[model samples]
Target: MALFSIQDICKSYPGVQAAQNVSFEIDEGEIVGFLGKNGAGKSTIIRILAGVEQPDSGTISMYEAPCTFTMAKQAADAGIAVVHQELNDVPLLTVAENMAMGLGYPKKAGILDRRALNARARAALAELHMDVDPNALVGELSVAERRMVMIARALLTDAKLIVLDEPTASLTEREIEELFAVIKRLKSQDVSFLYVSHRLKEITELCDRSLVMRDGHLVADVQMKEIDEDALVALIAGKRKESLTSKRAERTFGDEVLRVEGLDPFYRGSPFDLHVAAGEILGLAGLGGAGRTETIRQILGANPNLGVTCTLNGRNVQITSPKQAWDCGIGLVPEDRRNEGALLNFPITHNITLSSLKLRRSRNWLPFPSTGKEAREAEHQITTLNLKTPSAEESLANLSGGNQQKAILARSLSAGCKVLILDEPTHGVDVDAKTEIYSQIMRLAASGCAIILISSELPELIELADRFMVLSEGKLVASLNGEVSENELLKLCLTANSEMVA
Candidate 1:
């Protein structure tokens, strides 16, 4: 008998049929890949399995016994644990407290035993080789560390199956390797995993069998060894899509539109100088903590203390704040879309026109937001970006992750930016969404917008970037033009104290 099984699961939300007769099974000690595009019923099924949502008609069986799970606690009692894409830890609490949540705290005679709790948290984290302090607040930990805590918490449960949703979206390459090692160790002990991710490479490397979903149905179930990356992409995308490398072509460059110099002095490294021409996409390549994000922050005036010189369109500009950067025709689609990009509570119209509210005003004298104009602009953006929404008035939180990302991109472009900075634009989106984003970016570049693309995926950078600037330990180590291989980029990212090139 299979360890866990879902048969004929059906779920619907308002006008959307999220899942339709979905069925799958995971054998004991197997890591199954759950592959699908955004809004393709993957999240719906996962939620149903976790008991966060109930299916209209379905049967879930564990160990060949029919199970009924109406709440998260019930699911947990049934030996099911889930680590969602959006973290569930309380930010104000310490690591130990967050881990002990839902699970009772260690207590003696109705008193909380702090020492015991800390010891347990430490033991749990140590199992994953996570070097986090139990007393450290969850808000203070980095994204990768926080993820480790979530995984550790899952392991602490009496769960036979763990569902990991986009577990490596925020992890660095080294951190990802460590996570894989931990997963392998758990699998040895007979823990099954339902690994959901948009990254085909991760699926290929880790999963034993792959299940593909599209349009609220299970489309394909194939053995890992029987399929390649191209086949996987085709399965998720419905039809065979062109390779990302096929989109590469000879890009035309224009006059210098943005320049950065002398940021390294504040970062305590060699001097940094760079220039981006109009209609050009400059790729910034580096590993985590390699100064790529810092460089972009300095250019956007997000790091005010960083003494950096910037020039726009041959004119020296002093950008001391994000507002100043916006006024200078610069906009950044930040890496953390949940925290920095979109207001989840707001409607799509508000998010799309948020950065350019001044342009939506009816008149200068009144100085009030014009709802009609905002809606019109939002509609245009929705059409242009292919944002899937019922209407502009729909809440941003209601849309899928890919649509939310596109809405954020619309906000960046709505301000009439001349130099657009996209940091991991397609970080959590699926293959189809990624292709759409790439096409939109290419169009933006062709229309005289200078773009700075920063991505941890070296293959994506190698395919899209016209020129590459590699950062290592807060320093610019290499600058190369034309096509480059992923191995060369990874080498540059790992190398320290390389000679700086102009």
Candidate 2:
């Protein structure tokens, strides 16, 4: 008998069929990888299995016995634990307190056992080869260090079936290796895992079996050895042949759109300077914390001035706020889209017209929105971008990740932006959506919109960028036009930080 089995699970929210007849099983000591694009029901199914939600119709069994439990106590009692993609550590609490919160620690006749709690927390950290002090506040740690704390928490549990949701999404390459090593150790101890991720390469290495989900249905279940990367993509996207648009000749190159000379934004980094031309596509390439985001924020008026001045269309201008930048025909699609770009609770129409409410304004007392105009614009953008939403009135949160991104792009375009800045435009997006986003960027450039592209993925920068610049230690170290070699860009970007140490 399998260790765990979920049969005929079905769940529906207001406008979303989160899961439909989703069935799967996992054997003890086996690692099963779940592959899906965003909104493919991966998280929903895992949540159900972890007892966070009760499915509308389903049967979850352990060892062929029907399992019924509440969300609170059942998860730990049933030996099911989850480590979310986002860290859940409390900033003000020490690592020991956070780790021992629900474990009923530091208690004897209502008295606290401080020494025992610290010792246990220290042991958990030590098991993972982490040397941080157990009494340190979580907020004092870095993103990677916080992730290690989460790992330690999960390991201390008696969890037999663990569901990891995008555990490596924000991890660096070396940290990912450490996590995989830990997983290997756990697998030897006969623990089962349901690993969810969009990274196909990691799936191949970490999973014994793989399951593919599409639109709330389990479409494919097979051994990891049976498929290649291309085949796996075809399975997920439901298409065999796909092509990215080739680079074309520039139709028009207007005057300088936004000029930044000697722009320096100080946030634990060196100073830098650059300019963006109208209808030009400028690419920023560097590893994390290389000041790419800092420079973009400075241009968008979100950074405190170290020493920066700007000119728009040959006229000197001052932009001290985001609204000022918007008035200057600049639109920013922020990296953290959920928090900064889109209003998650609002409908797609609201999100699409947020930056360009002028497009929907009609003749009426108090100047209310004209539904007719909003619908027309929404339909055009939806059809043009191939968004997969039932209607403009559907909540932005109801749409898939790719569709949400497309909606954000539509809003930026509708705002009449002469310059569009995108940070990690394809982050967390699938292959098909990546191609579509690149196409949209090209279309904007063709229509005389200067684009500033910032990305950590080198392949994406090379494939989509017209001209590339490398940032190292917050300094503009190199620039290349037409065709930039990957190796050359890497060498240039790493040289500045390398030189400082020498």
Candidate 3:
């Protein structure tokens, strides 16, 4: 008998059939991959299992016994724990305090025993090979360390099954390896995991078997040993995928469209200097803490104290704020789309036209938004970006992660930007959406937009970037053109020497 199993699960929201007739099973001591596109019912099933949402019709069985849990506490009592992609820890609290929530604090003589609580938290962290101080504030911990604390908290509840949703989304390569090590250690002690991620490489490395979903239906189930990454992507996408390759035709770039100099104090090293030509796609490659994001922030005026000098179209320009950057024709599709890019509560049309509302005004004297013009532009963007939404008036929160990202991209383009900076544009999106986004980016570059692409996925950068600039310790260390290998990029990112690569 399976340790946990669900059958014929169905769920729906107004104007959306979120999930229908979904079924899967996880055996004891098994790590099962829950693979799907952004809106393909994976989240619904996870929520149902965690007791955060009730399925319209379904039966869940644990240890061969039928079980029904209607609330999160009930699910926890039944030995189910879920660690979400967006962490649910109180930043102001210490690690021990966060872990002790809902479990009661240690007490001695009717007084809170802080030492005992810290001891317990320390032991729990040690069990997962996590070296963290229990008294440290949760906010002070790195993303990776905080994730480990979440898992440790789940273990405190004696959970037999745990679900990890995109657990490595914010982790660096070294941090990811450490997480895998912890997962392996826990699996040895018979902890079953339901791992959900858009990254095929993680699933391939960690999961024993994978269940693929499409259109709210279970499409395929395959063992890890029997499937490759391409086959898994094909299963989730519901079609065979061609290779991801750049379709850029050989063309000469025009004069430099954007230039930066003296953006010091960005990371801890030398001053920066860079230039991007019109119709050129320049790729920035680095590991976490390598200053790729800081570089972009400096360019966009997020780091005003950096004293950077910028030039746009051969004219010196001073960008002291994000609004200034926007007015100067520099549009940035930020790294964190949900938090920084899109307004989740707003409608898709609103988000699409938010950065360029001035252009949609009826007249200069009495400035009022032209609803007709806004609708027309939103519809055009929706079609062009292939955004999956019922209508432009639909709430952005209701759309899948991929659609939200596309809407954000639409916002950048709608602003009439001459220089586009896409920071992890395809971070949380699926394989099909990634292909579409790459195509759109190539099209943008072909149309004379200077593009700067920064991605942690080296393969993506290698494919799309015309030239690569590698950053280490906040300094430009190497510049390479032509075909580049992931190994070469990794070496450049890890090395401390500031050697130039021609």
lDDT of each: 0.85, 0.77, 0.83
Model 3: clashing residue pairs? Answer: none
Q: What are the RMSDs of all candidates, in order?
A: 2.6, 4.1, 2.8
**Residue-wise C-alpha lDDT for candidate 1, range 302-351, written one tens digit per residue:** 66666788999999898988778888889899887777778998999999
Worst 10 residues of 3 by lDDT: 263-272
* Quality of model 3 by C-alpha lDDT: 0.83
Worst 10-residue lDDT window, candidate 1: 263-272
Candidate 3 regions with alpha-carbon error over 4 angstroms: 91-96, 102-104, 107-158, 265-269, 359-366
Query: Each candidate's TM vs. the true structure?
Result: 0.91, 0.84, 0.90
Candidate 1 or 2, higher TM-score? 1
**Residue-level lDDT tens digits of model 2 in 1-502:** 8998999999887777878999999999899998876678887787788777789999999888889755735866788878765456698999998887656677667888888888988998887777878889988875557777887888888788888887765454445777888888999999999998777778999999999988889999989888887788877877773764556665467777878766554454545556677678889987655677778878866654555677877888777787788888888888657546888899888888888777677764536778788888888888776676767899987776557877886788677788888887766666666676778787888778888998766667887777887776677767778676777666766677544210
Worst 10 residues of 2 by lDDT: 493-502
- TM-score order of candidates, best first? 1, 3, 2
Q: Which ranges of candidate 1 are over 4 A from the true structure?
A: 108-110, 269-271, 357-377
Best by lDDT: 1
